[model samples]
Target: MSLVRVLVLEPSELDPVGPLGDWLRDAGAELEIVAPAEGPLPPLGDYDAVVCLGGEMSASDDAVHPWFADVRKLLAEAVSARKPVLGICLGAQLLALATGGQVRAGTRGPEVGPLLVAKRDVAAQDPLFADLPFTPDVMQFHSDEIHVLPPSAELLASSPRYPNQAFRVGACAYALQFHIETTPHVVARWCENSPESAAAARPGDVDDGRLRSVHEDIAETWKPFAERFVRLAARYAGSLPGDPPPPRSLPLV
Candidate 1:
């Protein structure tokens, strides 16, 4: 299959696509990066997929950053059209709000640094998360969380601190309350600049060697998942609803 053209939205300067962009390229997907910190979203329907990256802002902070309102509209449109959508961290919280879900400050303090989330039972039936480890290593830097999922949203993963960690709404849209795109440099900058991240780190947790090892583990697991996502977008984009499979020809003598 050919590469899927993806629209990547960055809500803030502090959050870049990082390893997510690299894996998208490796998966034969092209990205159109845009920053909507101050303005509205670009004209939609020009891309095969939508990837909303994380930021430090809360989803309900449209009073401060008006662009968040526009992002919610775009996410709703993607969900309505059944376009494959991936939301990370703040992006995930936005997805929850874009639908009927709710987002609020984490009750268990900041879930920063390396963490593990156990896959939920429904994850065994999900296309993207079916093969993921029971407990996957993911980078966490969010202080807010999804408190209530929208109607019909399937909870896909959870941690001791955050119950609404990963979920899927509709058929093709996914919302993840963790960070899978951070590289070592990204983690370092986050730890240095974000007070929540720095305070959440325990001794030796932010060491270069320890962080790099976790990044490697994340890449090993998530890169394939990203490739699979691109493939799903390609297949789902053209598949007609309730269409029957084409008959195959039998080998001739």
Candidate 2:
């Protein structure tokens, strides 16, 4: 099989691809990590899949972060072309905003620390989420949230505080408001950099031991999910240009 080529966009220096990079590589993908601020973005056609990582910037702050405009355009183009895409945290908010949804400073305040988000009934039939536990562990650190999903999106998971924890915009595009790619050390650095967000969590929630345990739980649940994503990308990579796209309603498995 041809290697699946994936473009991993890093919108913030603080939020690199992290463990997700290892997961994609181990799953047989060739990845290119790009920071839009450093240079012009490559065309979406160059890769079979795209993964947009989280950032500190608000998704709609195009004026403050000019590179956001190009990033949103790439995400929109990737979805339109039916390329497999994964958007995490701010990436998720950007996906929502780029596709006719809304994003804003979360009314409930920052959602930080390790947490569990319940999978919706719809997720039971989702290609990537179906096999996950009823509630899966995830790391949260964003101050903004996706208030509305894209018109075509299917809600996949939710939390009591944030109902838009996860959603699928199309057959292969997924967005997650939580983080599955962070490690304990990464969380520590994030806490240090954004003490306000860290302070939002309960006193012990962001502690080293708790962060480590939660990351273990997250790895068990989401590593397979990441692998499944690579398989989806590989399927797309193997198709001839003129071939019919995968059925929109069927699970890739």
Candidate 3:
């Protein structure tokens, strides 16, 4: 089978695709990273899946980063096309906004550090989330929260502080408020950039040893999740033009 073609949208230098790229590539995907500021993006039809990375900017900051509008449009288009799409952090916020949800500065302050998010009951029926643990470890660094999910969006996971930690729009488009692509080094850099945000976490949460340990835990749980996503994308890519639609509750194999 041909490798799944994935378009990876990176909105900021700080939040590149990072480990998620490695995970997807190892799972048999060919990724094309695009920085909307650098040049025009390739047509979405060329790829079978999309992964929008996190960014420091707010999702609705079109005045400052006009490319956010373009990114949201692309996300909407991909969802409409039934292509697999994964949006992280600001990308998730953009997805919510593009699909009629609301995003604003988080009312509870920045949710940073290594944390656990509980899977919603409905997640048991989701293709990507079905097999995950009840509470999965993730890295949180966002100051903006997706306050309202898109109409008809399925809530997949939540934390005590953020109710919209993860959600699904339509069948295959997933949005995650937290970060699974971060490494210890990446977290250290983020801490350096936003000490105030880092300070929001429990003491020692941003420590080098703690970051590394949490990342190891995150990798153990989320790497398979990433692989499952690639498999979903690959199946979508391999389907014949006239094949019947696959069931929404795809097998975890």
Candidate 4:
């Protein structure tokens, strides 16, 4: 079996690989995390698959966060290469923008809690979302949304508030507006820091323990998704046995 190599891009301090990392490791895939905010991105040609995590920054804020432009370029390259790519939240917006889709401040306002997204009819044929429940539980904490998906993108899942929830571009690339990687602690930290959560707070203010309880559902639904992604990476890796191995450690420029 070929060794699956995955490049994970972390654009901020708060966004870390939680459960998804564990699932990847369990599937025997190696993960290298790159923090482009610190320095330059490594060559996009290195990995079999790429997973770009969510961040607080808007995808189009290149002036404020200059790395976004580079990130979008890399995403476009990955799509052109037909490499399997998964983008969560901000990363998803980046994928959309890189491929000619539009993104702007979310019209539905900030979505900062556990919720369900109804899988679209197209999801029935998707490798990642096909087996998912009709209304899969996912975590969301973003103020920006994909306003229009690329013409080549396939709509996979959605909610009433956000119609462009999940989509696929090219054959192996996917973009998810909601998060499937967050754990309860991750969600808790997000809630504590998010002004949106503060504004939505009631007197009791734990959101009915919905944040804590939904993690089990998240694990149940997304673990398989993550594993399948690693398998996709492994399959890609097989085609390049003699290619140079992935970087031993993340580039920390």
Candidate 5:
């Protein structure tokens, strides 16, 4: 088969990324990148996987970005097509809304920095997370969180502040509250852009260098998990409802 076509619904103009791009290139996936507010999503054509990256905007911010309205439809199509869909942060919130789940404010506090994901049985042993990094730290920087886990959704991991840190929908689909693609370079930029939010999230102040170091470590720890995710997605490539075959290998490049 040819390269798996992947559609990336970017939340902001910072849509094109090097690390993610490298992975896609190595995975032999033809990537389509687009900003959220650009326009309606072209039908999920020839797409084997769909990825919705993190953004400063909220899933509920439909009034500001008209394109957000079409996100639900696209998400539905991905499921309808049985293509793997992965949502990150804001995208995760949107995924919740798409699957009849609800997302509300994080009552505890904003989760930021290199945090530990508390393992749950459903994720710790599932194909999506099997033999991968367990109890490993992942980079987190978000204000709102998902409260109600979606129907047919399995809770994957949690943090001290947010319970539903990660989840899997319909076996193949995934929604991640934390960031695994946080590169060494993006940390400074994220911290700079999210100064107030970061300050509000952490009781004690964190310096830029320390935050960058933490991000590097978190990104490293989550590598095997991401590899596992990639492998799980491939197994469902020829998937149809009520017919799930054995897992395939998606080894890291």
Candidate 6:
């Protein structure tokens, strides 16, 4: 079998580290994690699949982070090349932003725990999510969300607060608002430092217990999703084409 090359963009303390590295290694995908601003953004053409991990900074924070333009261009090029791309949290928001979808501060508020996710019809039938837990407890730690789905994009999953949790840009590209790649320990480490969650429990803030519970769910769900992503990577590493945009449905609960 040919090797699958993956590009992972990381810009936060909680971004995938040892655990996820092991996860992807076990899944047979060779990954190169790029911390864009910290280091240098590598050429996008060499990668078979591009994976953008979540970060504390919003993808829309162009004024503060000049590096965002490079990140945006990489995502756009990935889509243009029809390469399988995966985005999580800010990364997912980046995917939306790169593809003409609108992203804004989650007006519904911060989603910080196990959420009741509502899935679109396509999400239920998605091959990438065939093993996903139903209404499964998924980890959420963002204060922003995608407000619009780009043209021909498939709305996969959503929650009460954020209408778009998971979406597909094309046949091989996908974006998810939840952190399926995170582990309980990983979140604890970050939450332990995060001033907001570290100080004290604000009215509706998620405490350590709630955070751990959902993170466990995220770890469990990661295996399947990782497998699916790797599968897409392997396929795309071998071929590239603009596949037809699958039909989509906006399930308004």
Candidate 4: regions farther than 4 A off: 201-208, 239-253
After superposition, the stretches of candidate 2 with alpha carbons farther than 4 Å from their true spots are 239-253
- Of 3 and 6, the candidate ahead on lDDT is 3
Over the stretch 1-253, how does candidate 4's per-residue lDDT look in tens digits?
6667889999877889888889988887789999988888988788888999998788888889998888888888888777789999989999898888999998867776777899989899887888889999988788888999987689999888889999998777899999988877776777778866445533433354765678888898899998888777666566434432342321111
Writing each residue's lDDT as its tens digit, candidate 5 over 1-253 gives 3456678888775433446655655656667887757666767765778888887777777788767768866876666556688888888888877876778877876777667787787765676665546686676778888988877789988776778988887647788897777664565566688886677644432566766677667656555555544544555564323345553332111
lDDT of each: 0.84, 0.87, 0.89, 0.82, 0.70, 0.75
lDDT per residue as tens, model 2, 1-253: 5688999999988898988899889988899999988999998888999999998888888888898888888888777777889999988988887787899899999999988899999999987999999999999998988887888789999999989999998668899999999988988999999888899998899989998888889889998999989888777676434343754432220
Per-residue accuracy of model 1 over 1-253 as CA lDDT, tens digit each: 6668899999877889988889888888889999987566777678878999899888888889888878888888787777789999998998889888998888888888888999999899898999899999998888888999988899999998889999998778899899898888888888888865578767777889999999999999899889888877777655323422332322110
Better of 1 and 3 by TM-score: 3
Ranking by lDDT: 3, 2, 1, 4, 6, 5
TM-score of each: 0.92, 0.94, 0.94, 0.89, 0.85, 0.85
Question: Evaluated with TM-score, which candidate comes out highest?
Answer: 3
Which should have the higher TM-score, number 3 or number 5? 3
lDDT of 5 at 67: 77
Candidate closer to the true structure by TM-score (higher is better), 4 or 5: 4
- Show where candidate 6 strays beyond 4 Å: 193-213, 239-253
lDDT of 6 by residue, 127-233 (tens): 78656766766677787879988778998887877788999986667998977777656666666666563333344335667766666666677766777777777
Clashes of each: 0, 0, 0, 0, 0, 0
Cα-based lDDT at residue 160, candidate 1: 87
Best by lDDT: 3
The superposed Cα distance between candidate 3 and the true structure at residue 43, in angstroms, equals: 0.2
User: Clashing residue pairs, candidate 2?
Assistant: none
